[model samples]
Target: MVVNTGKTFDPQRMLGTMRLADVDRGTDASGNHLIRIAGKPVRWALGCNFDVWPWACPATASSDAVRFGGDIAQLTDPTDTSIGMYVGTNAYYNGIFFEEQPDGSHALTTDIAAPHYYADGSTVITGSIRFRVSYDLMRTDMGIPNPETLTSTSLAGAVKTPTGAPAAGKFVTWHDPDGGGFFIEASGFTFSRKRLLVDAARITPTRPALARTVRKTARRGVLVHTRALPRGARVTSYAAYCRSASGHVVRASGAPGSSVVVVTGLRRGRSYRLQGGRELQGRPRCVERAAHPARPSLTLRPRAVPAARPAPASRGRPRGWRSTPHGRCATPTPCGWRTRSRDSRMVLNDSSA
Candidate 1:
């Protein structure tokens, strides 16, 4: 077997660089065994050939197996099945003893141990078996983590956060059960819910004219008071912003549903505007105007009243002229009725209301 107690050798360059040994036997055999040298583990491979010729008649073809163990004592007196790996070949034989039987031959190209494992190159073969041993060097850290040493925190702090917030889905964080700390995400847990804030199409914005008088405060700030909002609409939040030499700078934000918003840290000479965020529970009902008729306009006709009995000529009253209880004179005109009040004594000859 190849043993390197010094620097590691490159695998690509180490190809065809093995030290090989061949052993031929007919009985059971063991290839080789090794112990760790310095700090590096041993690396090895084995190839074998099994043959049963026609001349060895009447003898049944048996199997051969190979295995690795920690020590020679353990290999000699194996207690558990974990100590060995079985290798074998198959053959066909007639039930009758003298009948023809098929010959058996088995071959192994190269059997390499799993990564991160030491190849002890130990084996036992039976019945006319021949094998070769090839040895090389491998890096100690060339494989995945050992299963026996894995724990819950093995992948701790391995997750990375995205640069921007995702439009959908969730961000998951892992917690360390032993340390009671957050890992793989943010430092603390933040809980939030999606809110259907406001429907602009169904809601009206706050009007500046309806604002209350701004009251200045002692702390170089102003308390902006607002009047009652429109029906079904209320202020959700407020902010105060002022135009600076560069751009509009927001000074502060106020609590929800507050009529008086306190905006601080204002410059004395700069004008600041206070704005309120509004949401509508529901829109106000609108009164629609009456619909006009499709056809022509209507015309009203006065009913014909029977002509007042003509005043008697002998009484010296004019024709169709009569007096009522109020002492008002009524006469019939071609258009409609005509009346004369005593105060004016004026003639009502036109059909007017």
Candidate 2:
């Protein structure tokens, strides 16, 4: 299947492959024509999708498969069409291409295979080249009308949520280029694949971001807290890195696209830098960002002051001592009952005398 798209399938070894030309087979003694397929050429069926790359001619609906998406095939003879191994349609002279539409959209959407008959005006046999066709909705949106050079770095399926918070219980679902769906149950997730897509879906019920927030003290009783988050920009896994005691750069990964995740047990006087992106359910990854300055004061708070209480009544004054106008006890002097006044003067009671 991959070979039809001009790609090598390395995961599995090819036992072998063979090819055929128009003259390879001729009318036999019975006047019946013969054709051959080398090795087990992957068969193309109607309406079934096969994952393929951009710019490569794609296998499509066979001429005989009437029960399918649509009957779109191109037919050309020696003059109007040339035949060869090629990608995009070129006037049907050599390679694959349907007649151009008024909108400049040209395509070769039907596979040219054997075990099929040529219709008088409908189907005709072409050269043997298993190729691929471009999908209208997904590819052109990827900007492959004329076939662009492709790479995992160049694909664009990651999209920003509508410039605001996702509605309650709503989340973005990640899909691969092949139309398979995946998502992080509680955190952001990333996967490695080009031509991938991430879109938002709001169902009847919403789900929560399963994030893990941590608050731990790596320094003297001071907890440098970090909150593991579920929602943010980007759709890949995230990481935080800090210098460890062994002078090594230690890292901690949080939920994919986690908005807030705490990396704790960090030493004092050490700064941490964050990198990586939110993750989905796949292996591919990209970048995103979340940042904050060093704030290490969560364990201490101010204490309240207590009000002053009234003093207990002084016990019976010593013998003749009595209370004076000032806040002091007065002693009887030889001249008379005397006390130091608030004005810092000694006053004598001559009337008592």
Candidate 3:
């Protein structure tokens, strides 16, 4: 008789009280049949734990065989255990997978090629990306206005005046024929009128007259030549005035011709004019004698009186005697001289006579 083994496996209850060590034995509940062992249980489980939904599935497989699901596939290396599958949103796809190894740790399955849908992660969260952005701002309404255009016709014509002078501070603008505009400092008068008015009002300087003509004459009198009229012709008059060097006019009427005009009484080196213009110009020459005709010749002789002389010695004194207690002269006197008391007079004796 053949027994039918058609029991459905429940993943949650199948390995209920079984330790990992017991799972090493490939035993069904009946324990009557032995299952094939492809490799070590731990290594097998670790290898099959990798993500591989596209690879393998078995029909009528028990829960123990497919409990990990058709999504897992066997890793060629027993070192892989854990599994990873892509569940990305939008356009992203898995670039790498993680797997658990026999050591109970996870690692990337570097052998598998990445999916075609996989892409490099975006640096920004926004879906759209641009390399750069540029913006420019320009002022449209604000700018400097053009300078006001000026014309020659805008200026006033030249000002005109009828009678009085133009009022102070009155102003008028005049245009240059060349199109330059300017304001006049004055107003109410024509250009020529203003010039003529100024000329009439301005002060005029007067020309100086000739100085009085001076003439000299000689009249009869005792003319004394002096510094007052030192080198000029001598003159006299009934009513005459002497001019001092200080510009003083001293009058002397009815003075004698012999009267000496002392130039010393006047200042030195000054000019004066004599009276009687041309009327006394040709009078007879006056004759006068010098007051001291011998004065000039006397100056040539040496002065008779000695300028100074030493006092004589006392009576009965020897020719060279001195009255000093040592009987010697304190200082020598010149020849023909002597020394005496302070109050004694000096006498010049003509010994040869």
Candidate 4:
């Protein structure tokens, strides 16, 4: 029996289904004819299955009788629309696409040698063939309509979503002439790709400026602030560099779009050029080490007085006692030596003198 499996196949899930076309002769005389439902062409893959009854080649021989090679000749004639078989065999056209006829129908013919063979038995020794053709109604089998016919005001209108509207955070993307594609993001968040290429050329970036503040950290520190970015601009992070240290410039970074960056380990009285968005100068000072007082000193003066006589040279000057050229005794004064003091008169006596 022949069965057509195309009517019940699912286009979304199934590639295609096989349908029995027809047989060449015998009780089944159906022909190869595919009826088109819609005005669409079919791309089909064809195959043939042949079933031979009464296994024995000669009627008098038993079913197990050994059949010689070439007992059933191969099919001939290029225009033949029939399948003949003396033995069970299968034939397939592999997986190649063949478009349906302009009238939406497809047919195939196969040749068989001595198509009609009869033997003396209750069962006829003819062959029954089923030509199964597989065709896809979806996917590659169908062709897209002309693009010029499609019109829409927005992408959302042309390509609709199941929910009738795009979901949050979704975007409509299109390729730019420069290269990468850009999209209009739904949320208010700034998007880099969405920036109009023309706007880039028109909007000039203002000279970058920096604001700095002192940090009261254990170690001397400074905080550099960066200006906010322009509209539709995207920046991941900011870095500050010292302009003087070209060879080994110290770099400090801050989070994306952050206002301030911390820079520490600075010299007390030294100055630094901080360059984040722009170059700026900074200095660290110590104000807790400059607030004290002083002290006083006293000096004594000797008043004019009669010179004291020097001790005899032979006796030598008494130890620890020296005579001044002005006849004033110093330090270990001799006995009975008197000197006027700044506050009042004072006298000293040395027993050795």
The numbered model that scores best in lDDT is: 4
lDDT of 4: 0.28
Candidate 1 lDDT over 1-353, as tens digits, reads 33222222211111111121111111112323322211112222222122432213112112322322211112333332212211111111111111111211111112111111112323311111111111110001111112122223322111111222322222222222323122221112111111010011212223322244242421234445454343213434554443344354545555546655565544323344443333322222321122123322221112223444565799887765654544443544244343433433333222322
Clash totals in order = 0, 36, 7, 2
Winner on TM-score between 1 and 4 is 4
Highest TM-score, which number?
2
- Computed on alpha carbons, the lDDT of every model, listed in order, comes to 0.26, 0.27, 0.22, 0.28
Predicted candidate 3 versus true structure: per-residue lDDT over 1-353, tens digit per residue: 11222333211101111111111112366653332212112100111112563322222111221111111122344322221111111111123233343422222211111121112222211110000000000000101011012122321222222243332223322222332111122222211111111100101111111122211111112223221121111223233334534565533333224323221122222234333111111112222221223322100111122322423754565543334534433455322223331334332211111
- lDDT agreement of model 3 with the native: 0.22
How many steric overlaps does candidate 4 have? 2
RMSD of each: 35.2, 23.3, 57.8, 35.8
Candidate 2 lDDT by residue in tens digits, 1-353: 12221122111111111221111122345544332222232222232223442223223323332211111222244222222121211001122234333323332222222222232323322322222222232233221221222222222222122232231221222322332111111112111111112221111011223232232222211112233322221234544544433564545555543445455444433333333222332111212233233322122111111222223457645444444444443444222243343444333332232
Q: How well is each residue in 84-105 modelled by candidate 4, as lDDT tens digits?
A: 2111211111222323433232
Question: What is candidate 2's TM-score against the reference?
Answer: 0.22
> Which regions of candidate 2 deviate over 4 angstroms?
1-90, 93-236, 244-248, 268-353
Q: Return the TM-score for each candidate structure.
A: 0.18, 0.22, 0.11, 0.21
Model 4 weakest 10-residue run by lDDT? 191-200
Segments in model 4 whose C-alpha atoms lie over 4 Å from true places: 1-199, 202-208, 215-220, 243-248, 278-353
